[model samples]
Target chain A: MIKNPFLRTFSLGVKSLLLHKLRSGLTTLGMLFGVASVVAMLAIGEGASKEAQDQIKQLGSNNIILRSVKPLEESNSNQSTRVSVYGLTDGDFARIVDTYPWAEDVVPVRILQQEVRFGERSLNPRVLATTAKYQSVTGRPMLEGRFLTESDEETVSNVCVLDYEIARYLFPFRSPINERIKIGADYFLVVGVMLPRVPIGEANQAAPGEEVTGEVILPASTGRKWFGDMQVKIRAGSRDMEQVDLHEIIVGVDSSENVPAAAAAAREMLDRTHRERDYEIVVPLELLLREQATKRIFKIVLASIAGISLLVGGIGIMNVMLATVTERTREIGVRRALGAKKRHIVMQFLVETIVLSVGGGVLGIALGLTIPEVVAAYTDMQPVVTPAAPILAFAISVGTGLLFGMYPAWRAANMDPVEALRHE
Target chain B: MAEEKSKAMNVSLEATAKAAADTRAVAEFRNVSRIYRMGDNEVHALDDVSCRFNAGDYWAIMGSSGSGKSTMLNLLGCIDRPTNGEYYVSGTAVSTLNDDDLSELRGRHIGFIFQSFNLIPQLNVLENILVPRFYLEDPGIGLVERARDIAERVGLGSRTDHRPRELSGGQQQRVAIARALINDPSLLLADEATGNLDTQTTEEILELFDELHSDGMTILLVTHEEEVGKRAEQVMRLKDGAIESVAYNRPTIQR
Candidate 1:
C-alpha cells in the first residue's frame, strides 16, 4: 500500500467498535463508575480535612487554654469548705494581668449551663460571663446590636447577648433584642446577638463533656452578683444530692502570636495561688496537627479501596475483549486470507480498546465532578472535589484498559487462518 | 520455381507465427508434489503433477471429490507452495518465493474465483472489485474507470453499489467475476465458479467465460462436471491425485 497501513487498520478497529456500540458502552460502564468513585471519595476526604484544619487554625495555632478543675472529693466531703479553690479567681486574674508584661490580654470567664425562660418558651442555653474585650480577642462577631461595653462591666448591669440559634429558638417569630429573659430567678435585658459557629473537636463538644449549644453572654461582674457563684445540684435520690460549680474560665489572648506566651504566664500566676495540681490544659493547635496526619492516612486508605473497584473494572474489560476475539474469528481469518498483516489485526483491536477507555473516562470525569455537589445537597457532611483526583482517575482508567486489552489483541493476531475460517 | 519457393516461405512464416502465439504460456508445473500429513498417514494430494497452460487458452481440470483438483488450482494461484520440484507463474519460480513475495506475485498476476463467490459481505460490488488493486505499489491507474469497465463487461454495472447480500446468487457471482478481472491478470483460476448457479445461469456464465477466453484472456477452470469440461479448449482428468487423461478440442470447435 502507498499510504501507512497502520493508520488504515487503526481506523478499521475504531469502525468495528462503532459498529458494536451497545457492547462497547456496556463494557466501559465499569471503568466509568470505578474512576468516578475514586475521585469523588478522595476529594471529599481532602475537603473535610481542610475544613477541620481551618477551624483549628482559627482557634489560634499558638494558643494553650487552661480550664477550671473542681475535684469531686472536695465538693462531696464538705459543702461549706473554708478555702475557695480549683479555678482561677478574680485575684488570680488580677495578679496575672499585673505581673506579666508579655501577657497581652487575660480574659477570665465564668460559664453556666441552665434553662432560661422567655415567655412560654424555655431552652437550655450556655451562659458566658466575661469582660468587654472577650468578643474581639476570640474572633466572635456580634451579629446585631452592640457588645458589652466597659461601662456595662464596671457597673455590673443586667445586660445579656444571645447567640444566633438561641435568639431564633427563644423568639421564633419576634426579635429578642431589648427583651428580658429570666435566668434562674433574675431577669436580664438582651443587648446583642452572636453569629453562628460550627462545633469542633471530640463528640461535637466545644470542650470536654460539654454539649455545644447556642449561648447567652452576660457581664462577669453582673453574673457573679446575680447568679452567686452559679452552682447546679444533680439529685442522686430524694435525700442525696451532688453540687457542681460554674467557675470555668476561657482566657482569650490578644493575638494568636502571643497565645502561648500569655498562656504560660497565666499558668505561672495560677501555680503560685493554688497548691494542689487540679487543673488541665488543652491546645487546639496540637490536636489539629494530629488530626491532619490521621486524615492523610484516611484519604489514602479510602483511595485504595476505590482502586480495587477499578481493578475489577479492568478485569471486566479483559473478559469482554477475549469474548469479542472469539466472536470475530471468522472476520479475522477473512482479513488475513485477504493479505492483512498481523500488526494490522493487532492495531485494529487496540484502537477499539482505546476508544472504549477514552469514552468511559470522559463520562467518568463528568460524573465525578457532580458527585461532591450532589452529596453536599443531600447530606449534612459536605464533600469537596478536587481537579487532581479526576485527572488521576482518568489516567489510571486508560492505563488499565491498555494493560487489559493487550492479551486479547495478541490472541486475535495469532489466530490460525485455517482454523479460524472453519469456526462456525 | 521462384513462385513455388515464395509460397513455401509464406507457409513456413505462418507456422512460425502460430508457434510464437502458442509459446506464450502463462504457467508451468514441473514434477510438482504436495503431501498432506494426517496423524501417521501421509496422503499425496498431487503426485508429480506436470502441466503447461498458455495465454488466451481456456482449460478445465476434472476430478472426483477426493482427487487433487483443488490442490492443483491452489498451487497455480500461489495460495499454497509446492513440496517438490518447480512451479512457475508468468516466468517467476513461485516455489522459491517467500510468503510475502508469493502474495505480491499473486496480487500482480493471478485472479481467483471460488465456488462460494467469496465477496466480503460488508463491502459493495465496486469496493470488492477494488480490493486487489490496493496491494499494488502505485495505484495511480484510473480505478473508477477500470471498475466501471469490468462491471459493464460482467453485466453488473447497475448493481455496482449493491452489497453482496442484496444481490441474487447469479448477480453475486457476476460481481466476483468482475472483481477477478479488475486487475487484468495473466491467468484466471476458477474453482467450480458456476457450481451454485442454475442451468440457465451456468450457461450464461460459461458463455461469458468463453467470450473472455476468445478476447486474449487465459482461464483455468476446475470442475467435476463433464459438460463444463467440454466447453474448454483442453481438459485434464485426475484420479487418485495423478493425471488420468488429457483431451484437446476438435478443430471446428471454438472455446
Candidate 2:
C-alpha cells in the first residue's frame, strides 16, 4: 500500500493545535504529571529497595549471628535484686573452633551499658568489646582515624572507636581522634569515629523508641582487662554478682552454601556445652530472602498508584478532544465535501491527539529524570532511574492517546456532511 | 488500451443517452422525487421533477421560498440523494454510487459555489483553491501552477496569500470561484454566487461567469433575481417543487 500522507496530516495537526494553544497546553498538563509521577514513584521504589539490598548484602551471605540470652534458671531466686548470668561460654566457643575447620573468623563481643565521660560531658552508651573484624563484617565506613587492628588486640591497647553521635557530644569543638574518654577508672584513647549507618527498613519508618543508637568500640583484649567478663554486679535495690563469659559471636564460613551446615554444626557444639537454652542464631541471608519477597508487593502498590494518575491524564485528553471535535464540525464538513473519507477523518484527529500525548510524554520523562536528583539533594531519600522507566512511561502515554482518541475520531468521522456544514 | 475502451464506451453512451440527441447533458435527472418529513408531515421538496443540463450550456434556476430550488441545487452538487428516481452525472448513475464514490464524482466532475462564499478562514487564497485538489491522489501535473492560474483568472493575482477575513466580499467570492474551477470540473453549480455582493461586484461576478461559460464550461446557477436569469441562455422557473416553465432569453450577451 502507498504510505498515507502522514507528514502533511501531521503538519496540519500541528497547525490546528497552534490555533488553540492555551486549550491544548492545559490538556497536556494532565498527561505530563501522570507520566512524571509514574517515573518518579518507580525510581523511589527502586532506590529504596536497592539500599535495603545493599544493607543486607553487607552481612556476608556466609555469615551467622549468635546473640547471648540470660537463662531464667536463677531468675526467681532473688526476684528484683539477684543477678542471673547464663550465656555463651568459653567452652562452646572453643568447641566451635575445633569442630568447623571452614569457619574462618569467630568474632567474640562482650557488651556492657556504661557511662562514658570526657572532661565536662558524660553520656551513657553501650561499650562494645569486639575485634577489628567488626568493621569488615558490618561494612560501616569510618569518618575519622582508623579502626582497631590485630596489633591493637595483641598489645591490649586502650584505644576505642567512638560513634559520631557520642563523639559530637563528648568533644563538641574538636575532632574526637586521639581524645580520651574515661570509662570507669581508665581513660581510653579514641582512635576513630564511625559515620552513622543509613539505617534501613523498619528502623527508619518507626516511632521513637529506646533503640541502641550510639556506642563505643574496644579491642577484645582491652575490654577483658578493663571490664572483666567473668564478674559483673547488678544494682537494683540490693547488689548481686553474676558470671557471664561472652555476650555475642559472629561466625563466617567459606561460602553461602556452607552456612547451614556450619550453623547446624555450631548449634550442636553449643548444645553440648550449655545445659540451659541461652543463645539464639540468626542468618542474614535468610532474612534477606524474606525482605526481598515483601519488597515485590511494595513495588507493585507504588506502580499502581502512579498508573492511576496516567489513566486520569488519558481522560483529560479525551475531554479536550471531544470539545475539539465539536468545535471543528464545519471543518469536517468542508473536508468531506473536498473528498475526505471516514478513514481520512479518523487519521486527522488521531494525529492531533497523538501529538498532544507524545509531547506530554517527552516532557514528563524530562521532569521524572530531574525529580530524583532534586529529591536526593534536598532530602535523605535516594531515587534510582532505571532504563525501562522512561521508555515504559513514553509508550503508555502514546497508547493512552490512541485509546482515548478513538471515540472523538469516530464521532467526527460519522457526522453527516450536510448537517456538519449546517453547524455553526 | 484503457483510454481507448473508455472512449468507445462514451460514444455508445452518447448514442443511448436519455436526453436529446444533439445536446449531450452532463447531468440529467429522470423523474426525481425528494420528500422531507417534518414531524409526521411529508413535504414534497421535489415532486417528480425532471431536468437535463447539456454540456457547455449556461442555465439559471429561478424560484421563491419553498419552491424546492435548494433541493435541486443540492442534487446537482451531489451532496444529497433523491429519495426516488434516477440521476446521472458524466454518464454514471449517481443513485447507485456510495458516499465515497459521490464525493469523488463531485471532486472530479462537479464544482459547487455557495452564496456565502464559504472559504475556510484559516487558509489563504492559494491554499483555499488547493483544497479540492488535495483530495486527489496525483492532483495532476503542475498542481501549484494550475492553482496559481485559476487564482489569476479570477482576478486574485497578487492577493493569493491573503486570508479570507482580509479580503473584501467580491475578492472572497473570486477566491471561491478559483477553488471551484481548480479541478477543471465539467459541471459548475453556483447557488446565489452574487447574493452577498454589491451591485457592481455582482455584475463583475456575472461577467466572470459569462466568460467561463463561453470557454465551454457548463454552468448552472440558482437564484431569485431576474437579472441573474437574464444572463443565462435558458431559465427554469420552479413553483412548489415542480417546474413552472422553461424560458430562453433573446440573445444572451456575447461578452
List clashing residue pairs in candidate 1. none
Per-residue CA lDDT of model 1 for B1-255, tens digit only, reads 432443354344544433443357799876777888799998999998888898778899999987998788777877676666566677666645665676567667887776778776656788778766665555556787788899999988677888788998888888888877877899988889989999999999999898788787899999998889999989999998889998886442344
Across A68-185, the per-residue lDDT of candidate 2 in tens digits comes to 8876664347555555678887776677677777788787888876678999878778889999888876667899999999999999999999987778778879998888889878
Q: Model 1, A1-424: lDDT tens per residue?
A: 2135556455555656766778888888988888878878887898788778767765555555566776555445544323334565666667666775655556777777567989897877778888887676566677788889899999999999988767877887988889999886789999998874344433233443344367788998898787666365444432222232335444555455666676666677667777775565666766786988989899888888888988888888888889889988877755554554466567678777766776777788788878888877776566777678878887887788788889998999888655665466
DockQ (C-alpha) of model 1? 0.11
Which candidate comes out best when scored by DockQ?
2
Model 1 DockQ class: incorrect
Error of 2 at B108 (Å): 3.3
Candidate 2, overall lDDT? 0.82
RMSD (Å) per prediction:
10.6, 6.6
Per-residue lDDT of B101 in model 2: 81
Considering just the first chain, candidate 1 attains a TM-score of 0.74
User: DockQ of each model against the real complex?
Assistant: 0.11, 0.30
- TM-score quality measure for candidate 1: 0.66
